[model samples]
Target chain A: MSVLLVLLIVFGIGIVGFFIGRQRASARETGEVKVHSRAYYHGWWVFLVSVLPAVLFIVLWSAGSSIYLERSAQASLPAQTAESAVASRGLALSMVRGIATGLDRLDAQELQNLPQSYADLRSLLGSKGVALASEGQDYMVPIAERWHSQAATARTIGAGLAIALAVAGVIFGLSGIHPRARARNNVERIVLWGLLAASTIAILTTVGIIFSMLFQTINFFSVVSPWNFFFGTVWDPRFADAGSGGSQGQFGLIPLLAGTLYIAFVAMLFAVPVGLFAAIYMAEYATPKVRATVKPLLEILAGIPTIVYGFFALVTVGPFLRDLSAAISGGGGFIMAQSVLTAGLVMGIMLIPFVSSLSDDIITAVPRAMRDGSLGLGATRSETIKRVILPAALPGIVGALLLTASRAIGETMIVVLAAGVAARLTVNPFEAMTTITVKIVNQLTGDLEFNSPQTLVAFALGITLFFLTLAMNIFALYIVRKYREQYE
Target chain B: MNLMTERSLEKAVGDKMNAVASTNKMKGDKVSVFYGAKQALFDVDLDIPEKMVTALIGPSGCGKSTFLRSLNRMNDTIEGCRVTGQITLDGEDIYDPKIDVVELRARVGMVFQKPNPFPKSIYENVAYGPRIHGLAKSRHELDEIVESSLRRASLFEEVKDRLHDAGTGLSGGQQQRLCIARAIAVSPEVILMDEPCSALDPIATAKVEELIDELRQNYTIVIVTHSMQQAARVSQKTAMFHLGNLVEVGETEMMFTTPKEKRTQDYITGRFG
Candidate 1:
């Protein structure tokens, strides 16, 4: 039977169960004593009992049987063909299944017109407007035929077993519909498990990602020494991509790590003071009319996409800085359009609304009583802000800054467009450099051998970047929580 | 408590206060206030006596707190609030352009209903006021000022050992007293308290009442309280207000015992607010 028809029948049985259980529960209240549970609860109880077991059986049966059928199809082939087909079993099985479906589409007259031999089956099917990749390789015929028969048998059994289980569940549910039956309690427990499953999926995916990175990082470390990767200064990885038996290149992390920190530091130097002052003016000094007009205008900077910011940096800010540097240095400047200074300044623009808006919210959250106490003591407004307000909001402000720092470190688009991929170790902000993220992107873009150190190194860099951000987020959350406890 | 009926009784008390106007520390002449378009106070004429605790008692939203806040220009912080009147401190018109409000606030301090201690060491919390006003010559003088202020607020003994601890760590009553100490550290002449004991227990309230009695020896105090018994205990003079009108003003004993206005009688005897 078709899947849609089966679904309709299963739901029809659930409706029958619902009515049976509700009527049985109502019948127990013999015109004087009342039923303990509501009629809706009894109906839902019967519906769930009738549908869940049958659905679970169908899902598990389909998943388990498919794998078993694939293996048997492969095993039915001769030894040489099976050996050659092992690496491409999934692809091979999909094509064979497609051919079987095409044959199932034939009518009685069409089947009689086709030749009986396996050799002519391709042209015969082709005449019926079906195509195969390689006209069904020599050993695929027996496997395809067997798969066709096995699939039909599995479908028949799955339908029969699902309907029977649903019927049994319905009978059991109607028998248990007494006044004292705990349908609500059972439903609540199921809901709790459903919520638990939803939250656990996120945590489980994070763990799975970490383990996958850990395995690949271990592989990379086996080939590249930890000492060379951590401490060495030079960064020429072109030799590693020259195929096997070539001299391995230096895998030092210091230069990329330095570029990342330097750009982030410069970005912070620009963002922190500017954002903080803007927050103070908005929170403490601006009139309500002015604040209402200005705050959302400032937040519009946050709503802009970072890719657009990258485009602006690449086309606009970088050239402006380059021309300004030449003018300042009198034509002897070393500044390029794609220097760290260019990237850092533009990245700082992207980060302004982040720092200002978060700090503004944190500052405004400080109690009004603190301000009143200070002002009442004859302190000037500036004095009150500097002494009382900032100190009160310091811990939360620190947490906000650290979170911005993580975002800066993880930032890719601005660095990719504005900062050149030179990977040089230098202190001058006017010089070009590359970050860990930019390097990761550079190594992973093209198709190549997967097992080579060149491709695998992205995973190693990825895990390093991941741990750095994870540590920051944890510390930021800790400080924020501690600050909340003090005031609350 | 009809306005027409209370006006006759208000005149009897007005004739009595007219004889004692010379001893007043602060005077409000025909003070009318508007917050946005709503009139919160009518023409309120009052005399705050020197070196004594005067309590302003009224039901909520009767403009008692509003009247108290206007004395120190604290209401100036609220936007869209306008006051049209002459309020003089020591015979100088405080609203005059030549008079600096910052200096005026230094001479008049306020305490809020809730205890708000700066998230700092107890020593810093008290020293904050004196440091801002440049009242202390050295760190040692500042320490002495902090000690004396805390002693005056009666919190020095409990917090002497933990001077470096955050002021927020204190109990509710102690924190209120700490705020008092912070205010007193500036050595202001007039102290305004808006229901300062409302958030405290009975014992703490009594302790604060005793401290208020002691403070009256040095500074002129104006207290706004909801508890009528509190107004009777802590104040030498009592002012009764009903629906934005000052019904009567007299000695606390006389005001509570033989109030001139029937409205004041109704409010004090729990007939209706």
Candidate 2:
């Protein structure tokens, strides 16, 4: 049975069961709140009973049947084709499955009158707007026929078992409805488990991703020594396939690490003061009309896609800096068009909203009482803000800065477009440099195979980047939470 | 019944405590207050005499706090709060356009209902006002001011050891005293307290009441309080207000013992507001 059809069937069963159980509870109810549980609880209890088991069965059946059908189809392929089919069983099974679905689209009369040859069958299916793989041979047609029959059998068995369970569940739900059954408590327990399962899925997926990256990183480390990856000053990933006069593979992370930090530092230096002063002005001095208009306008910078910011830096800021540098030098531009300065400047602009919004909230949260106390002491408004409000808001602002630093460090698109990918270990902001994220993209994009040191190194860089941001987030949260506790 | 209350109020005012009263240090001549378009105080006139504790006692929202805040121009901080008529200190109009509000506040400090200590060390809290107003010539002079303020607020002995401790970490009563010290450090001519004991326990209230008594020797004070007994205990003079009306004013003992206004009598005897 189709998954959507199974869901519809379960919903229909739940509705039927709800009415039956609701009727039973109402028939026996003495007055409102007199029963052990509410009539709605009794109805929900029946709905859960009728839908849950059948849904579980449908999920398990679908999973089990797909694996079983593929294995059986691969087993039944002729010995001559079996050797090749074993190597590409996944692809072949998908093709076989497609043909099986196409057979279903043809009713009994059309299917009986179908051509024996695969090309004729393909043409016939094409006229019906169902295309098969052109490589499907005459011998494979019989296998496709078998696949269709087995799929029908599996659907029948699955639907039969699901309907049987749903019926049994309805009967059991009806029998369980009594005055003292505590249906609400049962429902509550089931709901708790449902929520638990949902949260567990989120946590488990993160763990799963981390573990997968960990194994790949372990593999990459086997080829590249951890010492060289961490402490070496140069970066050059070259192999036989690396066209255009490439150097032999020498993976050094320090240049990328330095570039990342230098860019992030420059971005933060630009962002923090500008953002904080804007926050203070907005929070303390701006009129309500101005604040309401200005805050969203400032935040519109945040909503613009970083990719757009990337090219904006590429086309505009990069060229502007290059020309300005050339004009100052009086001969030629030493500053490259794509340099750390261009990326850092634009990334800082992107992060202004982040810092301002968070710092504004923290500054605004400093109690009115604190301001009042300072003002009542004969301190001017500016004096009060400087002495009391900023001091109180400092910890949360530091947290916001740290979080923004991590965002700058991890950002890929802006770096990729505006900061050229040379991976040079230069401190001068005018020179070209690349970050870990851009190189991670560089190593992994296009038709690269995953097993090589060149490709697997991306995973290693990925885990390193993850840990960097993770450490930043943890430290930021600690400072932020400490600030909150002080206020309380 | 309400007519009789107002009639008695007028008769009592005609026969009230103008005889042998202390000279008024700060006086309001028909001071009326408005917040936006709504009237909060209706042509209310009152006197705060020098070196005396005068308490404004009234039911909530009866404009006594508004009247107290108006004395020091504390209402100036509030948006849309407007005050009319003359409020004078030493016979000079403090609300004159030439009169700086900041200097006025320096001369007349305020303590709020809730204990609002700055998020700083206790020592710094007391020194803040003095330092801001440039009252101290040196660090030693600042230290002496802080010590004297804390001593006068009666918080010195308890907090002498941990003067570096955050003001917020102090107990509720201690925090209130710290605020009082903060107010006192500026050595203002008048201190306007808006229900300083409202958030305190009975013991804290007693400690603060004692502080107020001792403070009356130096600064003139106007206190707005809801407790009638508190008014009876700490005040030398008492004023009664109802529905933004100043119903009566007299010496504290006379007002409690023989209030001529029916509204004052009814309020003191636990009648409805």
Candidate 3:
């Protein structure tokens, strides 16, 4: 039986169990003693009990049967095929499974009158839409018949077991639906476990990603010395010919690191004051009508995709800056079309909402009494905000800015489109530079050998970027927590 | 409106009896206040005598705090709050267009119900007002003003050694006193206190009451209190309010002993709020 059919049968059983449990509990409610839980709770409790274990069994059975079929086919392999490489052995097993599936589609008369020769069997299976890659051997026909029978038996046993479990679960669940049964508690515990499992999956996925990248990064370090990869200034990872011994170019991290930091620094320098002023205006000075309209309009800037911003940079802002520079200098422009300034400017615009929205919330959280105290002391509104409100919200604002800085460092789409992929160690903001994320994308794209240091170096760069942002986030969290205790 | 006119007529008679006793320092003439569309204070007239603690006592939501906030124009900070009629300080209409609110507030400082100290060193909290107003010319002079203001607030002895510590680090009573000192640093002609001791324990409340009585000798003070005993203990004159109108105004002893208005009598006797 198909997995979906089994699942549907189990769900139908659960629905029946729900009604039975609810009816039993309601019947008990007619007595003098009151039911501990509501009828709905009793129904849900029965549904969970009937459905959860059966669905779990069906899933495991389906997974286990596939592994068993593959192993049996591997054991039935001919001596010459078994002695072949692992890749060929895998290919042969897939062909065996395919022939088994094709045979199941044939009628009883066709199965009884099977082809005897290898070529004839191939032709018959091919006619049935199962195209085998290699020439078939003489032992394949018998093995395909055997594999088909085993798969059928496995499916039959699995369907029988799942149905039995579901029926037993319904009986056991209805038996517990008495007046004093703690149905609600049981259902609530199941919900708690479900939520915990969801969060655990998310956390486990993050850990799994880190470990996968860590192993590849270790492999890359084995090829390139850590000292050279970290401290080297040049980032000339020349693409060597595949499978040919040639020069593996330098993979210095300094220029990329400098570009990342420099661009982020410039973006912060542009964003902080503007975003902070906007936040102050929204939180302190604007009337409710004006604030209600302005806040969402600013958030709309955040809703825009970064790739669209990249397109804007590539098509409009970069050229505009270059032309403006050319007009002033009266020569080939000193500023390149794709330069650090272009990327930083666009990235700064993207980060404004990040800083403003967070800082606006933090500033508004300062008690209204604080404003009154300052105004009561004869300070002007500006004076009150300067000495009282801003100082109170400083730590939270710092944390917000740190988060914005991390976002700027990790930004790739705008930099890839606006900033040229030139790894240069320069301080000039008008010149082109590249960051770590841009280099990671460059190294991994296109056809390349997986074992090459060029591709493996992407993993190293990814882990480095991860740790850099991780440290900043941790520091920001520490600052936010330490100062949050002051007001409350 | 009829009830307001009748109460004001009674208040007029009381004012005439005390006219010769003391000159008016700050006078509210038929003042009314509105928040959005809701009228919070009706046409009310009262006078704050100079260098005396004139307490405004009323039940919750009776507009006593509203009246006190209007004296210093603190209500202007609240959006949609409106005040009409006249409030004059030393014979000048404070609501006149020519008056600068910042300067007017400099002459009339206020303390709120809750202690709200700036998140700064205790020294900065007091010096903030003087520094902004340029009341002191040099660092030494600013120090002297800070020290003398803290002294007048009666918190100098407790906080003199840790003047550089955060004002928010103080206890509830100390924080309230620190706020009082910050207000005093501006050297305003009048001081408004809105339930200043409500957040304190009994012992702290008693200390603050004693400080208020001492402060009356230097500045004109108007205090709003829920506790009738606090009004009687710390104020020279007491004004009773009910439902946004002034029920009676008289000497503290007479108002407590034999109130002319039944509302004031019932309230002071704890018959009902």
Model number with the top lDDT: 3
User: Candidate 1 DockQ category?
Assistant: medium
Residues A245-325, model 1: lDDT tens digits:
567777788999999989988888998998999999999999999989988999999888878888998999899888888
CAPRI verdict (incorrect, acceptable, medium, high) for model 2: medium
Error of 3 at A42 (Å): 1.3
Per-residue lDDT of candidate 3, residues B1-273 (tens digit) = 121234434543554455457788999999999999999899889998988789999889999999999998999989999999999999999999999999989899999899888888999999999998999999999999999999999999999999999998999999999999999999999999999999999988988888987897788899999997787677768889888998899877668767898888889888878
Model 3 residue A242 lDDT score: 43
Local lDDT at A379 for model 1: 85
Q: Report how far off residue B125 is in candidate 1 (Å).
A: 0.5
- Cα displacement (angstroms), candidate 2, residue A123, comes to 5.6
Better of 1 and 3 by TM-score: 3
Sort all candidates by lDDT, best to worst. Answer: 3, 2, 1
Off by over 4 Å in 1: A1-58, A82-136, A156-186, A483-485, B1-22, B95-99
Q: What are the per-residue Cα lDDT tens digits for candidate 1 across B1-273?
A: 222224324532552454355277899898877899998888889988888788999888898989898898888888899888889999999888898878888899999899889999999999999999999999999999999999999999999999999998998899999999988999998999999999999999989988998898788899999988788777778888777778788876677767888888888877887
Best by DockQ: 3
Per-residue lDDT of A244-344 in model 3, one digit per residue for the tens? 66878899999999999988888888889889999999999999999999999999989999998899988899999999999999988878888899998
TM-score for all models, in order of appearance: 0.88, 0.90, 0.93
Cα DockQ of the candidate 2 complex: 0.52
